[model samples]
Target: MKAVSLVPSLTEAVAVTLPGVLAGATDWCTHPADLDVTRIGGTKNPKLDRILALAPDLVIANEEENRAADLDALRAAGCEVLVTEVRSVPQAFAELARVLAACGAPGRPRWLAQAEAAWAALPEPPARRTAVVPVWRRPWMVLGRDTFAGDVLARLGIDHVHAGHLERYPRVPLDELRAAAPDLVVLPDEPYRFTAEDGPEAFPALPCALVSGRHLTWYGPSLAEAPRVLGEALRAARR
Candidate 1:
């Protein structure tokens, strides 16, 4: 079963669960560090010609990460594109299983089971903290309503201040974000690299937690350790 994964998390899931099945992948599919598939391009702008040349049996993508026009074009060319929608942790697990099954895995992978168990094992937080999660900084876009990252953070007892916003990723002015009065400012490394020196200064009055984008955003093997990894970062910043 030849496949091309446009989502990095899905690419890792497929590569780890069923090795050598990937015929091509976007340039951003960086997990497994040693992945040797043909580089198609970025998720938002995949090279359709290159992907078509690979003649994959299936092209794996996500509703949020992939462009609708690109998926339509692939389908128009007779390539089977399996698009996934994962807005919450539960959805992520379900979608991962479905994508893997479509990729011809004999059964559910052990990592998926491990990830489920890990999240299930998390004890209820003693208290919940409100945070403003910034994904990008130039125009200052934040994680708003119904985002997978927001759901992941909510499970870890960090509620997004913009969770009630009308848009999923709203571009709020930096001044407005600072005025939101969140208990903490949670920053992830990707979509924008928010380092200690780079991001913390902006939220000088609030504690800033620099979290890993892969753990906070990606919904694959990283989910297994997200609770622990993200918890430590949040705790360290609070202290």
Candidate 2:
């Protein structure tokens, strides 16, 4: 089946699990290093005309990663769209299965099984620590309540300082963030490219852990490696 995937993580999942089925994907779908699919612009602003031109049998989208108006436009053009809502590890797997099945992908993906086993075998973290994770810088938005990243961090024994905030992602001033006095500050590479020289300097008094955005925020095969990958980063942060 020909399909177009708008979400970067889901795009990689489909491309790796089923191959050739992906006719097009957003420019941000960077996994499967050798991927040569048609580029359909960014997740937030996909080239609707280009996607419609593909005439895919199925279109994979995420409730948060894509815009409602774009999905509606595709549906209005007679394309069968499979919108997925992945808020946690379990939900991600369930939605992946549902989307793949709906797209008629043959065979059970080995990576899916491996990811499940990875999360299942994860040992409970020794202790919990309070952290503030920033996703962007200019506006200073952070991970808040009901976020997949928050759940992952919680499982890894890090509690977000703003998880109880009304906004899922809220913009907090640097002064207020420092005032919160998180035990540590977690930085990811995307939505804002936080690096050793860049991010850690801001929280001079607090320890900082720089982690991969995919490992921290994405829910796909990366899940299989995240626990270990992120654990190392978090453990390496210095006071």
Pick by TM-score: which candidate is best? 1
RMSD in Å for candidate 1, one decimal? 0.8
Q: Write the per-residue lDDT of candidate 1 for residues 1-239, one digit (tens) a residue.
A: 99999999999999999999999999999999999999999999999999999999999999999999999999999999999999999999999999999999989889999999999999998889999999998889999999999999999899999999999999999889999989899999998999988888888899999999999999999989999999999877673
TM-score of model number 1: 0.99
Best by lDDT: 1
- Tens digit of per-residue lDDT, candidate 2, span 1-239: 89999998888888888879999998988898899999999999999999999999999999999999999999999998988888788888898788777767675588888888888888887778999999998888999889899989888889989999999999999989989999899999987999999888888899999999999888777888888999999988757
Give the TM-score (vs. native) of candidate 2: 0.97
lDDT of each: 0.94, 0.89
lDDT score for residue 68 of model 1: 99
RMSD (Å) of each candidate, 1 decimal: 0.8, 1.0
Q: Weakest 10 consecutive residues, lDDT, candidate 2?
A: 99-108
